[model samples]
Target: MHPRSSLTVLAAAAALLTTATTATAATEPVSRAQVAAHFDLDAEQQPENITVDRDGSAYLTFSFARQIARVSPSGRTHVLATLPAPEKANTPNLGKAFVGGIARADDGTLYVTYATGTAELTGVWAVRPGGRPRRIAALPADGLPNGLALDRRTGRIYVTDSVHGVVYRVDARGGRATVWAEGEALRPSTFAGANGLKLHDGAVWVTNLDKGTILRIPVPARGTAKRIQVHATGMPSIDDFAFTGRGDTLLAARDDNEVDLVRPDGTHTAVLTAADGLQTPTSVAVHGHTVYVPSAAYLTNKDPNLLVAHLDR
Candidate 1:
C-alpha cells in the first residue's frame, strides 16, 4: 500500500465509470451496506484484511497494531494473537511491522502474512486455536509480503510479495518457500503490486495495486504454473476482493473508500461508497448472503471499522 489521496482516486474512479460502466448494482434504490462494528482509531485498530469462519465470526489482521483478532457475529471482538513487534521497525514500503492478509484453515487454524523488515520475523505465521502465533516460513525481509491464500486440497500456502513482485509457495506445516511465479504483471509500478490473492477453480487469482488489474494463474497437479492471464483491468487502488456465490462475480475493496461489484465480463459498478461509512476499505469477505468489509482508515485516520451488508440474492 502506498499513500494515494482519496480525492485523486475518486476522480479516477468517476472517469472509469464511463468505460467500466455501472452495472445494475448502481441503480439499486437502497444501499445494502451498514457499519457492523467500529474500532478505536486511537488504538490503531486498522483492519488490513479479513477471513470469515464457518460460524460467522471474522478474523482480522490489525495492520499497524500487529494483532490478530476475532469479531463475533454479534459484534464482540477478542484478541486472538499479538505478533511480536521488532525492536526497530523498518519494514519495506510501510516502514513498520504490518500484518496483512489472513486465511482460516479447517480444524480452527489461522495463517497470516507478516512484514516486519527483520529477517527473524518477516514471513508466514500460523495461530492454532489455543496456541501462540509462530512463524512458519521466513521470507525476504526486504520484500513486503501482502496477500496470502491456502489451497485446502493440497495444504499448500501461496503468498504474494508486493515489493519484489513474486509469488511464493510453502507447505501448510511450513518450511522453505519456493518462487512459484513472477512477471511484469505482478511487478510494482509506483508502490505495491500483487496485493491480494485467492484460490478458486484450480487457479491462483491476484490483484495488482499498482497495475490496477486482476490476474489469474493456473496451478496444475504436475506442479508447473501456466501462463498468467489478465482477468480484469482498470481497477486502481484495489486491495482485496471476495467472490459472491454467483460464480465469477466479485466485490472488490478499493483503498479509495469504495467497493465495486465486478461481474465476470470485466465490468463493474459502485455498490458501496463513503456514504456507507467506508474509510479506506482494505479487504472483503463473503459468508452466505452477508458481505464483510473492513476499513483500515489508513489515510482517513478516522473510524476503522467492519461494515456488513446484506448481499441481495
Candidate 2:
C-alpha cells in the first residue's frame, strides 16, 4: 500500500540527522532503520493524536472512525471507544467524527475532544477500559475544541478551541467548563490555530499551529492562570508533542514529516524526517528513552503508520 513510501527519501534524511553539534550527545540522530514502523491502520481511522500509558500502550484518536483505538506493546490495535457517527454527509466536519485530541487522567480515565458538526456529539467525552464514551462536557456551538491535556494532580482537563483561540478548564468529575484563557495572540491567523497541548513540570505548554509559536501558562489550581507568556516562536504547523522526560527535552511532531527535538530555551533541531520513514507525523509520545510518533497520512498515504525512534540511548 502507498508503494511502501520510497526508500530514497529515508536515505537522504539519514545524511542530515546527526549534524547538530550543540545537541545532546546521548540523543543520537535517528536513521530510517532505527525507526520501526507499525500499525497499518485503516485510512478511515485517520489517527490524529497519541498518548502513551505507563505500560507502554499507545492510545490514539481515530478521527474518521469516530472512535479511539489502543495499540498494544506488540502493536495489535483494537477500538477502545466508539462515538455516534454523523447523520448526514457534506457537513462541516465532513460527516465523520472529529475525534481530535486525547489525554489521560491519573486514574486511567481518558478525556477526548470531538469537534463534530453534530452538536450533541461535539464535546469532551470520557472513557475507561471496557466502557462506553459518555459526554462529560458539551463544548458550546462556537467552540472548535482540538488538542487536550490533563492535570492529574488537580483533577482538571484543559482543552484548546482552535477556532476561538481560547483555553478551557473542565472539572474531571462533572465536566463543567469555563474559558481559562482568551487572548488575541492565541487566536489562529490561518486555518490552524492552537493545535497541540501538554501539561508538564507545573506549566501548560501549547503550540499555535497557524501562528507558529509555543506558549506557556502557569498551572492553575482552580479557575484561570494569568500572564500567558510566549515560550517559543517561529514553529509553523507543529502538532501534538511529548516531554522526553529528560531535562526538558521535547519531541514535537511537525505535520511536514519531521519530529523536532526542542529544548527549553526554544531551540529545536530535526532528528527524524520523511526520509526517516515519517510521512506526516502528527503526534509524539515518549516511553522510556524511545519516542513513538504517528504518521497521520490522512489523505496522501493510504495506511496510517506508527514509527518509534530511540531518542536517548
Candidate 3:
C-alpha cells in the first residue's frame, strides 16, 4: 500500500462513513458532475477488467475476489459467478483460482479466462448469463492471458498474454488456438504489460498499462498489421477503456488514481481526478452517456466502492 493511497483512503472513509461532506476536487481541470451512486463491494473485490453490453449492463472481473460481477445502469450489482478453487494446492502462494480476460459474444454468452499457478489449470471459459461454465482451451504454461476481445463479424476471440507479450486467437467454438501477432511494437521489450483490448473499425485496440499506450493493430486478411500509438500522453497507469456511445471517444481509467476521457484524435481531458476521492481507479465502462469507474482502494483506509460519473456531453 502506497503512503499517499493510505491517507486518501482514510480521508475518504471519514467523509463517507462519518459525514456527507464532499472531498476536494482534483487539481487537474475536469468536466464536473455529481457522483450518481456508489456500488459497494466486499473487502476482497479487486476489479481488474470491465466490458459493457448494449443493454447498459456491465460485466466486471474481480481478480482478487475470484468472481465476476454485473452492474446494471440502475447501479444494481450482483455476483455472476465465482471461479472454483483447485482441489489441491499446486504452487506456493498461488491461490485456488485467478481470472483475467473477459468478453461477451453476440448471442449474449460471456467468455472469461481463468488460470492457476500451475500451467495445466490455465484456460478460457464460457458461461451463459445464468448457466454453468465450461472450459474451452488450455493456454500454454508461459501464457498469462490478461485481456480479451471478440470479433463479432468473424466470430473469433483474441487473447493477450501479458507474461509472454503475445496475442493469440481462439475460435468462437473454442478448439485450437494460434498466435495472431507478436513483435517489439505489439509486445515491446519495455513495459509491455497488456491489460485491456477492443475491436473497432476492423482494428484491434489494446492498452499496455505499463507503457501507457493504446495500440492499434489491423486485423487479419488485411495484409501486414502495424502497431499504431493511440493515447500515451496521460499518466503511465492507464488501465482499461470504455468506448462512448459515439464510438469516437473513450474513457480510460488510469488506476494511477485518475480517469481520462480520450478522443480518437488523441485529445484527452481529466474527467475525474484524485481529489474527488478516486483511489486507484481501475476499470471503466460507459452506458449511454454515463460512465462507471470501479476502484480498488485497498491501500487506502477508505472503503472500496464504484464511482459513477455522468457525462454532460
Candidate 4:
C-alpha cells in the first residue's frame, strides 16, 4: 500500500484528465458525513476487499493476518478463518498466506482467493458460515489472483491476476479455470498491473493499479476477446470500485487518501479526500446509502476503523 514511485507518469496523466473533466460539469462537491458506526480492528487485521450480503452484513479479507472478517451492521467484527500458512523458505511475497479477493454467492457461500508467497500455491477457496474453508482449485504460476467478482447470471467467478495482468474464469463449483481475458498490450510499459475487477452490464470492468486506469472488456458470447479503456484518466492509484445501487454512480478507491464518485456521464467529483483522515484507502463497497471504505492504516491504529460515509442520493 506504499506510494509507488513508478506510477509518477500515470498519476500526472490522471491529474490532467481530472482537471479537464471537472471543468465541464462543475457540480458542487458533495459534503461527506461520517456514518453512525465504525469497526476498529486490532493491530493484526489489515482489511482489503469487502462484500456486503443481502442481510446487511459485510465480509472483508484481512491481508497481513490471513483471515476473513465478518462485520455486523452495528460495527461488530469477528474473524471468520485464517488462511493456511505457506511452507517454510518460500518466496517473500508468495510465502505470506492471505486471502485477497472475496465474493459471496447467492447461496451464502463465500468464495475467496487464497495466495501463498509463491504463485504455484495461489488458488481459490470456498468457506461457509461457521465452517472450515475448503480449497476450490489451484491457480497457474502466471495466475496471480487478486480480486473476485461473481456473475450471478451464469454462475461464473471472475478472478484478476495483478502480476500476470490477466483475468481467469471458473465455474461456481470450482471447475477447470480458463483465461477469460488478458490485456492485449502485455508489455510492462503498456499495461502494468490488473488488481480489482467488477462485472456489470455484460462487461468486465478492471482497475489497473500501475497504469491508473479502468478497463472494460465486453463479455462476448464466444471466442477470443479484447478490452477497451472505458475510463483511463482521472484516477490516482485506483485500486477497487463498486457501482452504487442507483446504477449511474461509481465509487472508486484512490490509493491516495481519497474516494471519488464517478457519474455515468464521464464526470467525477471527490467525495472523500485526505481532509477526512483517510489513510491509503484501498477498497470500497456500497450498501444502501452507506459506503464502506477499508483503510490499510486501520490495521495498526484503531482510530479510524472502517470509514463510513452517508451518500445523499
Question: Residue 244 deviation, candidate 1, in Å?
Answer: 0.4
Whole-model lDDT for model 2 versus the true structure? 0.72
lDDT of 3 by residue, 133-217 (tens): 7778777754567788888778888887765667778887888777776765455345446667777777777777667777777
lDDT of 2 at 50: 87
Q: Which ranges of candidate 3 are over 4 A from the true structure?
A: 1-43, 87-96, 188-192, 222-234, 298-302
Error of 2 at 112 (Å): 0.8
lDDT of 4 by residue, 175-212 (tens): 67787787643212343477788888778888887776
Q: What TM-score goes with each of the models?
A: 0.90, 0.85, 0.79, 0.81
Off by over 4 Å in 4: 1-32, 35-43, 89-95, 184-192, 298-304
- Write candidate 1's Cα lDDT for 187-264 as tens digits: 999999988998888789999999889888998777657679999999899999998878788889999877888888
Task: Report the Cα lDDT for residue 152, model 4.
Answer: 89
Q: What TM-score quantifies how close candidate 2 is to the native fold?
A: 0.85
lDDT of each: 0.85, 0.72, 0.66, 0.68
Stretch of 10 with least lDDT, candidate 2: 16-25
Stretches of candidate 1 exceeding 4 Å from the true structure: 1-31
Evaluate residue 192 in candidate 4 and report its C-alpha lDDT on the 0 to 100 scale. Answer: 41
